[model samples]
Target: MPKSKNKFGKYLLIFWGLFITPFLLLIIIMFMASKGWIGEQLPSFEELENPKSNLASEVISSDQNVLGKYYVENRTNIHYYDLSQNVVNALKATEDIRFEDHSGIDPKGLLRAVFRAGKAGGGSTITQQLAKNLFHEKPDTKTERVIQKLQEWIIAIQLERRYTKEEIIAMYLNTVEFSSNAYGIKSASRTYFNQTPDSLSVQEAAVLIGMLQAPTRFNPARNPDRALARRNIVLSQMNKYDFISDEHIDSIIALPIELNFQVEDHNFGLATYFRESLRNDLLKWCKEHINNATGKPYNLYTDGLKIYTTIDSRMQRYAEEAMREHMTEIQKKFTEHWKNKEPWEDHREILEEGKKRSDRYIRMKAAGASTKQIDSAFAAKTKMQLFSWKGDIDTIISPMDSIKYFKKMLQLGFMSMEPQSGYIRAWVGGNDYRYFQYDHVKEGKRQVGSTFKPFLYTLAMQEGYSPCYKIPNIRVTFDLPTGDQWSPVNADGKYGGMLTLKEGLAESVNAISAYLMKQFGPQAMIEIARKMGITSPIDPVPAICLGTPDVSVFEMVGAYSTFANKGVWTQPIYLTRIEDKNGNILQEFVPRKVEAISEETAYLMLSLMQGVVQFGTGGRLRGQYKLGMPIAGKTGTTQNQSDGWFMGITPELVSGCWVGCEDRLVHFRTLELGQGARTAMPIWALYMQKLYADKSLNLYKGDFEAPKDPLNVILDCDKYVQPGDNKTSFDRDF
Candidate 1:
């Protein structure tokens, strides 16, 4: 009996040894790997000292609001102190209940998890999860995942030794990814609620913390119901852990999850077009000005640069709102006009243009796809989200059809600048940037229409043509310098026998403009335009006086700004300064100024333009909008009503607007509906109204400055003629 007992005990001991040996071996191997004794290398000292994470660069408005960011990761680090206690408490309650007591790992929780088969929750400490987040790479197979888990455990212990409890929480919060391009607590708070981390309420904090488990599955904007349920669960956890009272939990659970969902995409912001235009300048700047710390060119994507821009946030918002308001109404009228007609004159050409720009075409071409395959792809009807002023709408439309739809839509570009400082106050490149990216401000050039008359008038004034200089308004035939006889007629086709330069300009008389161009010579006019900062190429031909030359809104606004600034042409400046992540100044930008024309000449031109707004084509400024301030402006309508433009000037600001269809063939048939005053001037009036309503803006009021020295030009028309008198060639005022 004794011999049998001994044998049984020996067999039992052998069985226990077999069961425990593999587990013991795994522990030894993991410990060796953690200490660099095994084949796998642990995180080095330098890696522990400095973590490699992508940080975002911010674009700050002049009013000091974060407009948006340029980033690879969209991560903005915030200190623990900046985080609300509610957020911290929520994270602790939901993620790691024993976060405070645990060093790096909780042995008791691990035992409990093992016994309950992880039904209660994970035993991984916050530090462990952060270790996995920061250092552990995703594994493809189960064996690799086990190896990655071992690496996480080793790094977790290292993190515990290196950082404090508070630091671990902050780092964890900063490293995690929230939904919708929001990478950290600060960014997530801003993206989800349009607020900062420090201002997050208890419920808001819970909603953000609840996203940690699965960002897409519990996105507040995309999956509100699931996100709400997850938020309730987090609040319940807070109650169970005594982080919050039962009354607080009950109150929060009943409260709905309110979200201010602002998408952090490149195309969804107040200054999308401006930012896109600025990107090229920034890239060049980054190359020219290398970073002192990194010994490499600064990356706009990851260097965390604070690009301080000249854009005023309030004015920008107002400009965008005004554009949308007017464009929406205009679009309705346009739809009515085209109800019975096809919007596009050439559908095949439009489709070809679309095919060239389609991302799918580009991708397939890069992958060596055949042209037939590409064509088939474009011809097939596919699901797409089309942009509308109301919102993005999902529908089924072929790529070819989408282009035709976009062509039917009218487009607008607007820019406003301070004449004295040349600071671009507001810029709206298009009605909707997502649909139309062609920037009429700088990249696009359309016939200047009557907008070019100001440049011609500026030259005539410089050549000693007074505002009251009389010119015959009858039809005049020009024996062309190009050996081509050209006769231009006014839009109304009625000839005023004789008219002052101011009156002729006010009426946009084509005959008088041609005569002046023939007198001044197109070469001289072109030189004056160059002096006034018109960068676009201008043909030295007599027809240019009628604004046949194509020019961009940027050039027109800048040229107009010269007249407003009393002939001092300051090149428009978009960026004011740039700073490093630590707020150290990297570069400062100042407007480049040059004298375009004499102060007297500019003032004379300004007075002539004022006559147009007061009594002629732009009379609606007072009759319709009731803007009684001293405003000098010009209205432009291109041939066949293809483009409408308005250049408005005050003592302080100079703004230019262009409204047209993508194709010149698609336009209103009549001048009454498509003229600059009707199509574009109202937008300027509405925008200025909003500007004046904002008392905080303090846009200057009153009149433009008369020439400081004695004027060599006649300004007031009443001096030359009596009121209520109409005599041909008699210089009558009324």
Candidate 2:
């Protein structure tokens, strides 16, 4: 009996040893991991102070509006103060309920997760999740997962020791990826709601908090039903935790998820073309200028440089609004006129041009794709998003057919600038940036038509010609350097009499323009235009007087602004300054100025252009908009009614606009529907009407300043008698 008792005792002792030995070994391994003795090297204190996350550089408007950002992660850090209480409560209720009670690792939650196989709740606290987000990459294997879990625990404890709960939460929100290229709460808020985090309501906060689980699966814009259900679940959790009242939950849940989805992509935001152009400028600036902290060139993708531009948000809005308003009506008229006829003169040529411009064509060419395959791809119908006057629509269409549709659609470019300072105030590059990547305001070069006549008239004034300078309004033959006879006829086809330069220009008599060009010569005119900021290559030809040279709206506005600035031409300045992330000034931009023409000559030219708005083709400014300001402008119509241009100037502002199809071959059949007065002038009038109404804009409504010295030009024809007539001829030229 003694031997049997000893054996039983030995068996019991062995059983106790077997159970306790493995538990002791597990404790030792965990302790080693906690002290950085196991797995990968953890982030040190210095690393924790400055986390490795991509920061976006911002483009801010002059009015302090955040235009957009350039980033790899699309992340912008916000302080704890920027977060609303509702967002905090929603995050706490959905992510970690006992967040305030835990010291980073919640033992109670861990045991609960173990009992329920992670179905009831997650064991990792906010700090642990933040630790995983900040310090560790996602593990691939089961063994790697175990090691990562140990690392998370250690890092969570370190985080608890280093920062407060609020700071940890803000840091967590700032570092977590919300999918769709959005990183951090600030970016997520802007991406989903088009508003800041501080402006988020309880329902909005709940929606964002719910997205934390699976951003792609529950994206509010894409999956409204799933997003709504998840948001309601978050709301219920908040209600159960007393974060919100039951009555509030009931009311909030009833409301549908409203998403103002404005994509902040490179081609989606306001002034997208302008922003794209500015990015190139910044890229060059960064390469030239070195960062103070790193002693290296700034990376626009990573460095949080703040680009302060001269664009006014209000004026930009007005410009876009006016374009949409007038272009829609103008397009309707054009479509009606071409109901039976094909819009393009050479559809095949336009299609080939469009195919050359396509990315697929370029890539396929690079990859050595066969001609048949390329043609098949272009002809095949595929899903696409198309821009309409109403709104964007999704449809299935062939790429070639889409290009044809775009060619039929009339597009426009409008830009406004300060005459004196050269600051570009408003820029509308095209009808839509997504559909049209070509920036007409800066890149497009179409025939200026009668708009170029003003430059010739400016040359005339410099050569001692006046507003009252009489010229024959008859067909004139110019002996060209090419040894060809160049004779121009009037648009009205009525020639034979004398008219003042002002009357000829106002009526846009083509014969008079050619006669003046014959007399003054194109070389002198090109020199004056060059000094006035026309950067395009102008040919010294007789036909150039009839506005044959193709010029961009950017160059036209710069030249027109010279007249507005009392003859001092200042090159258009887009960027005002660039500051580093730490508010250190890196560079400041100044206007490039040159004396293009005399003050008296510029004012005399203004006197001639004012005749156009008052009594000639641009009378729509007075008839339609009733803008009674001291406004001077010109209307242009290229041959075959391809391009329509309007350049309007006031005491403070000068705006230039162009309206036409993507391809010059596609145009209205007649002057009734295709004239500059009908197409581009209305956009200028509408934009100016909006500008005049907005008192905050402070745009001068007064007339152009007269020359400081008395000019020997006849500006008003109220009492002047013609040199050959006994009675003053009151008959207008047109």
Candidate 3:
């Protein structure tokens, strides 16, 4: 053999041993790992097709306003097209400029990273990062990490083959975390800048992209200086990539990171109480309902449902505003009324009950703490925030004292609905949902007081009683089943001559209501009330005439809407429909309507109740506020001024309000300041004024509709109050 041939053959053998053998071995190992022949298992075809991620469910208003969300990860998915051009450009430039050009892994970038010791850039593509995000778990050892890295590479390759470039980008944006518990670009945009993904500006998009490197370190809200530096780096990359202009880069880089940072919370936003109240039904729905494609029940916190409600955002705003305006005044008045005295002084049992329900007490009790130890813990002064009319008051207080303080805090419930359709427009359940988790509009049951009278009067009207039917305004006594004498008193203790049913209903005369209650009995009243949508338990007692039953604002509003809907009782409905994240309709809802009385009876009731706003207790709505919109309303104050209430009905709407301290004994001592006119009417009045002012709502500006076929009952009491056939047909038991 020749000497030159020998030398070439030796060199080729060395090259083959050093490079080709190891490369082939590596290729074999990677293939085995991809097939799960090694330590870790790769995702199967089914998992690759539909990766699992927690997507938040949204509550949407009738106006399409997002009220709030329910979530496990606070993640929401948006279409790839929903992304702003600036966001995509900034992300690609900063994270992986060769993103679109590469398949799954960047070979050139890997070579550069290896040769340069990773000083220049990372070798991982956006698809690889997305792969890591999907299946990432903390590996204890370095060997496991190596296996995981290989698994990620294989998954990234699979992903690239499955999804388009735009889809991969969208998936990455939707899967990654942007800190503050916000996962996905949609939530990140809102959390950082209060903007949607499509509305994000170049500066905002850069700030969000910058957070991906070190979510907490570069968070614009937490670390503004680091965020600013990181944001400018993204802008520079955009400039280098020619994605943004020189002029645009200069202006954007000069601007500081401006953030409208608000962390997603259940307690923050409009209709917080309503959102919380609706959560129960939603959870039940998620458990009961099935998604046909998945063959499993929907997860309310993860299924990404869109709940469409009938709530008008403008009307809800007005209702909240009115409560804030009037409730503030009443809170001050309540404080003055109980000056130099504690509202809970006579009701110490309430304090003990509250103490038992407290977190500290419950925790200590669970840990086998003695009563003395629990008491000592409660007496210890601690820093906490207390809810007040002004704002959350930060104070150093003992738990015992804080309980007492909260006991004095008066609460409120208010609601409004369309009478004919029973669509609940506005709902305010409590003073503040964060501090008081109880929902007074739906969950709470308090003495409805004289708001209960309408059911009796409606029943009487259904039983062929005239608006001009005369009844003696004398004390009517009842013999109870317990052999006790029960006689209810009026707010004003004056009972004299005969008063027509219209006059009695207008003035809310208890005597006339009692006379009618004695005729029909409480069970008959309850039957009518049930048909009208009152679901609370009522005692079968004649004393119920004086409004003795405990009921919710929700029940009262639904029941009263029966009259305004022309005797067609329409049950209140809030949810209109539910849809999936993909905009597929899942479920639809409709309100229940039933004919409770004749149209003539409804019109007559409307005419009788109108006299209340014209001259009686609720007259302040017209006389003081000068609403003058042909409103029919009733004011109610329970015994000892424990609960104050107002129910207002117009042609279009039926709304009710109730105000009281949490405990029945925690109330105004005198009836003057605690009457519903002073406590609850102003809220309704202010709310209606705002609604009327909007001109968009077009509410409460019309009169109640009369009967289609007129004159089964006489509403013109001035001409019909003669002493003829309309005189007392039934003898009183007095």
- lDDT winner among the candidates? 3
lDDT of 1 at 619: 94
Each model's TM-score?
A: 0.86, 0.87, 0.93
The predicted structure with the larger lDDT, 2 or 3, is: 3
What is candidate 2's local distance difference test score?
A: 0.86
Error of 3 at 407 (Å): 0.9
Listed per candidate, the RMSD to the true structure in angstroms reads: 5.4, 5.2, 4.0
TM-score of 3: 0.93
The per-model lDDT (C-alpha) reads 0.85, 0.86, 0.86
lDDT of 1 by residue, 19-85 (tens): 6644775687667676765335457776776665678988888999877788999988778999999
TM-score rank, highest first?
3, 2, 1
Model 2 regions more than 4 Å off: 1-40, 97-119, 157-165, 222-226, 246-256, 291-296, 343-348, 356-386, 392-400, 707-714, 718-734
Off by over 4 Å in 3: 1-26, 33-35, 38-40, 721-734
lDDT of 3 at 400: 94
Better of 1 and 2 by TM-score: 2
Ranking by lDDT: 3, 2, 1
lDDT per residue, candidate 2, 1-734, as tens digits?
Answer: 99999999999986676556446645966787667676446887777776667788989888999877888779887888899899999999998988999888887787666557779677789999999998887789988787777778778888888898999989899887776778899998888888899999999999888989898898888888999999999999999999989777788889999988765688777788788778888899889988765679988988778899999989898899899999889888888888867765556777798898888899999999999999999999999988889999899999998887777899888999999999999999898887788888988889999999999888888876667767877788877667888788888789787888889999999988887877878888899889999889888888889889989999999999999888999999989889877678888999999998999889988999999988998888898889899889999999989999999998999999999988888999898889898899989888988988999877666667787677665566654455556765443221
